[model samples]
Target chain A: MPERSLARYPQAVTDWRDFSDDGLTPTLRAARGLFARNGYHATSIRAVAEAAGLSVPGLYHHHRSKQAILGALVDATMDRMLAHTRAAEADSDGTALGRFDNVLECLLRFHMLRRDDAFVASTEMRSMDDTLLLRHIAQRDEQQRMIADIIAQGVADGTFRCGHVDDGARAAASLCVAVAGWYDPTGVLTADEVVARQLDIARRIAGFPPPP
Target chain B: MPERSLARYPQAVTDWRDFSDDGLTPTLRAARGLFARNGYHATSIRAVAEAAGLSVPGLYHHHRSKQAILGALVDATMDRMLAHTRAAEADSDGTALGRFDNVLECLLRFHMLRRDDAFVASTEMRSMDDTLLLRHIAQRDEQQRMIADIIAQGVADGTFRCGHVDDGARAAASLCVAVAGWYDPTGVLTADEVVARQLDIARRIAGFPPPP
Candidate 1:
């Protein structure tokens, strides 16, 4: 919703960039951890500074405000995720369920790999103002609409056996949300491993086969 | 886990009779709203009391502490949910995926219909001390193990296909979590309608018919 602070991040972060690799500095990491553990409303600059092991001014120098830090976190996460999910959508040229699989895989990966970001994006986005909420909602709708289109196409082609596209879409949407509420990092499966299996699960739920 | 306080509730609650209907009074309602919106730690007795129009003394006169309220909320939600899932698990004469469907349908209904309780049960449970966490983890394992048994049974009978029962169980666990994040009351489907459609999806995902 809000524009990315090109100042905070070095030059452009292309699809090649992985936030876990080098994009996140100590300050950003602390902000993310605090926000994830304690919510945005409850978190304070002092705590973020404390987590980062920096003075108040030091933390403030990197970001404008706590809310801006939240916005930056959202933007950074969404930017990389947008890159990944867009790629998934690009592969959606097959059956309706095929496109659905592509998107579902991306959604699962986004939550698994970026759990904190996923929390910040979905829950903390409510802290955004009206204009930002509209823009963020638009991006979210774009993603949802893409999957909805796939389900609709499946119904039209008779590939997906379901009551209706809307019902299918709701089921699909609900499935993605569950990832955020339940993903455990220290648990059995690695994020990538879970994504591989969940992609297939998502496809079958959509009444389609796994990708060839 | 903290012993659930019947004291936080009124005489009806104290008698442990008609507690199901009348026990969910202003006190529990406040706890539900606070825990859902703010999570466990951030939710305070003062806030809950104010929201419920009860003074701090009055609130404390009921549940001695905030954490106790959370414990009670999680316990009630899980108690009902595990009962339904347990009932669903016992009736496993069909395909492995069919049993999974029954359990999944019950979970989605529990989550969507009782959203606040779901949130408190899943996320806020973490706010409990280590001892409570262990007990809660034990309860979660029981549910997951039940699911794994169904998958193992399906595999043995050649009714379901998966790389591993563990994988299926994990996917099933993740599937249940996704429901809490996105379910909306005013959405197209009623809670019953959503659960029915989700059951269809869960069956397909669990390899209900099993691949030839």
Candidate 2:
């Protein structure tokens, strides 16, 4: 990992402004907010600099371009999401369905907490140059494939039944990701409630019967 | 309905240019493609006119502003989708689950056919003025309610076993709408196949048992 990525871990940094001490620069955070709100194509480097309280030249000192900021955000988000999936599996009770539920719950909670970055990552794919888009998409597909593999394994072991494993997996993944687009943290449902509700939907999609 | 919209019905127009004859105009078609491809904010009136094979003055004669074009596109797409839902219900055999299946299959096929328009309608909601956005969202919510009501009826009838009717409805609707965002018509799956598979997933999401 790059030295700049150190601040992204949050636990590593006591102060958010200490880019030298920890790498979560204001410029990175501003870029993410602008891209998430106004969209990547509409946001300019000047806007990001102003939001970050830096001169254009000062901003360039830390990051090369707007694309670089977007690339970093996308990479970090995918990395974190994939890590959550693996962690969920490792902590699971060793059944495919249990692993599936754990992974779905992890994804639901992750998307809720990182909703803004998740929105930018999903909606701004077209704004990225081809190579960066492909790189990020590969990370996303790897996450999807992990879910797909679990569904396939469940089918093989008679733990799950569905019309098609791949379709079931995609539907399951899509349902979870869609939560980030519409979920409101301040809304009536608590985060735990949202996760629990979505896990139920995911289980149904995977052809697992509801618990009695 | 306007006379120009008649050509949009397909059976009424033998020649493609009948839209011109009826004053439906080529400008509308050009705007949809440009907005869907380049995005709403990035696409300008000059670009839309050029793509329509018209001078700027000519394009303005058809559409006074870009917002009008986008408004028309969003309104028409929502109207068509709602129509499909109602028609599916009207033609259904009257069981709640059968009505549910018909509506899901109809939505899947309509989304696949109008994928580009659907894309623009969804992603460009932010670019619309607040009043227009609310108007379109009302239509979208109405469509969601249709599915929600169906699930509610099914659950009350003991035909479905969902945890929560509203969340299940939202998840089912989101999964179907998302099909437009990623579907490739020229890819391995045909439209019928996509509809059939999505129907199966919808069934599971509704907490119905798979077909024997």
Which numbered prediction scores highest in lDDT against the true structure?
Answer: 2
| Candidate 2 per-residue C-alpha lDDT over B1-212 given as tens digits, one digit per residue, 9 for 90 to 100 | 24225324333223311112322346777888877666777788999889889899876765668897888778767776776677777777888898899788877776777777777887787789987899998998999899998988888888887768889889988888789867897989887788889988898888886223
Q: What is the TM-score of chain B alone in each candidate?
A: 0.79, 0.85
Top-scoring candidate (TM-score): 2
True contacts kept of each: 0.30, 0.43
Candidate 1's error at B100, in angstroms?
A: 4.3
Q: Which stretch of 10 consecutive residues in model 1 chain B shows the poorest summed lDDT?
A: B10-19
DockQ of each: 0.33, 0.40
- What stretches of model 2 exceed 4 Å from their correct place? A1-24, A210-212, B1-25, B210-212
Q: What is the interface RMSD of each candidate, in Å?
A: 4.3, 4.3
